[model samples]
Target chain A: MNWMRTEMERPGQREQFQDALLRGDRPAVEEMIRQELADYPYWRDELLGELTEQYLEGAVPFSQLTVLAEAAAALAEHLPPVAVCGSLEGNPGDTGRNFIQMLFRAWGVPTLDLGADVPADHFLDAVSGQGIRFVIAAAFSADDAGAAMLLHQKAMERGIRDQFDLLICGAKLTEETGKKLQLACMDHRAAAVARWVVQTWKNR
Target chain B: MEKQMIFPANRFALVPDRDEVFAWLQCDAGPCRAAFEREWVPALQLLEETMTPVAVCAQRNANALTVFLTIGKETEKRVSALFQEERYILGSLLNTLCDEMLFQMDSKLANILQRELVSEHLYMAERLEPRVHLSPETLQADFGSLQSMVPFARVTTSGVLYPAKSMLYRIVLTGESRTVSALHDCARCDQADCLYRNRKHESLREKEKLPERELKESTKRRKRLVWREEIGIPVLLSSNASVDDNSEVSRFMDYFKLADPNDAAYGALSDRVHLLTC
Candidate 1:
């Protein structure tokens, strides 16, 4: 190899080459940045999260919002379907539910979402009556699980257990108790859960 | 096909025919479409309560639509009576009814939609409000837009939206393609560690490995690797490796590329090959 070519093969060369691809302003190299990031395993989550945070903060375009939403939905479909119920007041989980719903659509799973602040009876009624494959009971605070448990119990009582499957996920299912209940423990990484579920379900 | 609610703020309109539903949604006059959508709420209210499929139709040029619900003859009659002399309020009444009806839904049926792909978008609105009208002529000219609105998700016909969710994209060889499919449950997988494995594929030895504290946890794990019975028959759905199954899934996966012209994943299965599997 030529000495100069070998010299150009140093660690910094990749970054320099990437930088050289940009040629000038940092802002103009977004496409190059995207291409470079595409194959990076961690890039999808980081880019998605940044874009999501920006959109939620009202700093991103609606088109970008849709892209983020679609990616999230694709991820959400792989996991067990969860339904979160809570008052919108001071509860960010409800917002998370909306984001997940949009993401599920993007990922190609049709989601029937009943919005937040829903009455526990109504929630139970759906749990009792519909063949919900999974019931994702979400409560932002400690007190929320009471209602979720009641709904879960109601499903059992109504014989809804035979028809559908239920998976409770959220802030309320503490790690310690999650193990107790034998519920699938999921981290706040929504996309990760979604992807795992899809992969798991497919392999299953 | 049954209409399923996939996410929050999700709405489904059951018209006698999908074209008419799209046509009404596309009307230029905001109130005209609003009046129509508003009128359908009561009917939806009834259908949701009865927990059955519904078909709604409008009288020619009458701002009113007739709803024929199939929860049962008696329940439909009662619902019709509720609508006969009742004054309708758009949001409040519908919202309240939705709350009540959602409670009455058959959890099992709802669960089916949750577990299975149930709908496709026949039409999707790029923007909301002003009702966003696409007349019959427009739909015929570009019937494709209505395809997205199908109750099912992620189905494309010639890039046009269709209302079926029984398909998925699969990868063959190197490229990605779409296929009309029902995935086999992981319970059927030959691989023991297949993560998707649920109860249907559980092994007795694996069960014995759980610690005392983990017994309940083990029961909660989902089953894995079992393909739907229909998938095994090539006639019902083209086998993943079949020549006739040229769906978007085949095109997507391009199994041709995976062929390697030289067997790679299954050298043992190929007599001429020498790859080993332990």
Candidate 2:
């Protein structure tokens, strides 16, 4: 649908969407969203990306942002379920993990959220018990990174490194670390990772 | 004996820089820019009315500088409540902005130290440790007493800072003759958080002693390591402030009535008005 082109052509469409969402004009927002989905379903990721940007900018409240995320998730409901879980230490906020989950859901991949402060063994448990082959780990501070890296090492120790694909996202997932771990590192945006997941799944 | 000094909220301006805030909003684009202009004022007003910046500077021992910072009790309460209400995104953004504002204030403080105190080099506490000779665990343990310097901040049982929005730093001053290296070589390090820690790299030498087939497999797995550009939004350290329902910014939705919410200019004007009222 050439989402960028459409966004460029209709300069204020995103703002309109955000204003309607903020003003509690759900019907109007829903109608606009429906139109976009019906006409350019391929641009679902881009549309959600714009909404996430608004939420990050504080233009939309958390409730409204969740609603948008759910809406995006509903669009890709037909896709297969892909087990996903994330854990962060010390940080109570789960916005990054939630956003990634929503993006995965939008791509029709059902995610199993393990919540925060997850230990390395829990990730291995998910893979072994749930038959899930993909795992995502996130860390904000050095402490959180310590826990996340522990998870990576545990996965390796348990002989699951080659069995499952570990995707690390967050401030601590540097290029050097990703290279050393032999895992994929995602950008902060859920859309970017979702795109990678979609392409990888399709290619596979 | 350890020494500490408290800086009142008035000592530093906690308001965010206009350009940085706009940049954060990604307002350079046409649509987002229009929305930013509309919403900027009210957000600024809310910030000014609610925020009270406070800082504490202390030296745990003779060599290290520790600073504890927060935007006072009221804002912390407000942000905490927002999180409880499940307005996590808004709460997170405000929390992050406050941290950035504190950092700006810290930079100013550094400038003052360099100009007035004539310090040669100022090293940020987080930057200095783990990269230098000191470990975070050691510093975190040593600076445990500094928590009492600030009223709103505390150290958790895990030795991590609490009131997640609050910042605790331990900057150090060195003579010009000393060359400080902030970057850590993660590949060689055993630090758990070191992203560059190559588990296989360390074991490769040991694996060389294994059978040819096992070594071949190990080498193949190592060869698969590909570096991709690090992506993702920088994670802000989460603040664990308790929620307060009486937050002044809770009714933030009512502060601005977009005269034609769809109109870019109108939205911009409304935001400017909100900022102006502050």
Candidate 3:
């Protein structure tokens, strides 16, 4: 096995903090991120996101993942709380990462984890109880979209449809379903969606 | 009886690259501008010392194909020891490290399977791990099937593989011969939006030398056909003159029990296959 591995290809660090993050040297990574966030918010956000992807791919260790989460949490401190949940039917190899919540953190948004296989009533509760404005629904399989649609209909029934933004993400969600629910069917890339949300939130 | 093969120590034993492990550990390579490497040695040593790779492969013709690989129970035993000693960080890192260690064996394991498997047009598309590509029940049954093959391994009532590190890779086969590729597993993974996902856009003409006409054959009717083994759906691309897809789409969708035509599942079916006439 050793012989099969060629010269170890060590990648160059894109920023001062990345090498520290990868080593799971959280204190150093945090210090560097704290410094960068003072001026280079975009740089800090993008790099942390890039590293989280590596973690998801199993390239990095658990410690590195924690570093990424902590760093993202720093960026997200000023943002309002949001809600997150999805079916248990997808991302089976997730290894307890609960990455959508992490991704919400990465987007610099705090989240309330409603737990798995959550129903429409649970989402409505997060909205009403938490005064949450954005509800991210994940549908790994198309069938999982049903819960989000139900949530939307319930929101409308409660006369609160205009109060919150409903986004359905995951690989199999379609515009047709989004249109029917009058929801934003989105790509699962958290960075882009996060950017849009931040701008919208600021304006609102 | 199905052919069951056990890998010898040499066949299964592997040491993954120290650099890979180090980089993954996020160690320093300062002059090369890397993280400090020494910090990771104890952990890697713990993993290398503890893991004993054992593998068993079995398949029934056309029905099922599986290769079961596990770092013997000792690896997890040591991890549990670390946890009991309140070395939770090390324990967690060890757990993740074992997965990295196990999955790095994917290529060698696939090679072993290829050597033993007798086939014609059938070729493995990718390794589909349970829970990732399959449901718990499907994996439960797959494990039950393996009970007779890898008797040393065990499966819980809930379909969790035993030895904690044990992994079952289902051999996914496409109907036609594909260019045997070293395509990274990420390339084939269905998570199109995964930050780590890699997509290969090589032309069919370049990769397979498939004559465009033959692969995109339209039955004497002028509608073109596109197919993918994973989707098991035929995307019939008809121009303004022809229908949206083959007449078989509705029946096939029903047969597959797919959600709906407007669903992302069908969109994925279209995306996975190329538009031939274009």
Q: Pick the candidate with the highest TM-score.
A: 2
Q: Candidate 3 falls in which docking quality class?
A: incorrect
Give stretches of model 2 more than 4 Å off. A1-29, A33-40, A46-85, A89-115, A122-133, A141-146, A152-164, A171-191, A201-204, B8-11, B37-52, B60-64, B72-96, B107-134, B150-167, B171-278
| TM-score of predicted structure 2, chain A | 0.64
Candidate 1 CAPRI level: incorrect
TM-score of each: 0.27, 0.52, 0.51
Docking class of 2: incorrect
Candidate 2 vs 3: which has more lDDT:
3
Task: Put down candidate 1 lDDT per residue, B99-164, tens digits, no spaces.
Answer: 233222222223332233223211111110000111122222232222233322222211111111
Q: What lDDT tens digits, residue by residue, belong to model 2 across residues B1-278?
A: 86777777666755576555444433334333443454446556656767777767676454556666666555555655554443433454455456557556665555543442235244332223221223345446545666566645665433445454555545554443333322222331223432113333334444457655775575444323311111122312221112223353322212221112233332444443333221
Per prediction, the TM-score for chain B is 0.18, 0.51, 0.59
In angstroms, give how far residue B149 of model 2 lies from its true place.
3.2
Output DockQ, candidate 3.
0.09
True contacts kept of each: 0.00, 0.00, 0.07
- How would you encode candidate 3's per-residue C-alpha lDDT over B1-278 as one tens digit per residue? 66566775578657655544444444323221122233246667888787878777666565346667777777776765653343434554566577667766665777766655535445765555543345445565666656765666775433456665777756655555654432235433434443322211223333577565664452223223113434554554432211224455544433222222233444555343222101
lDDT of 2 at B116: 28
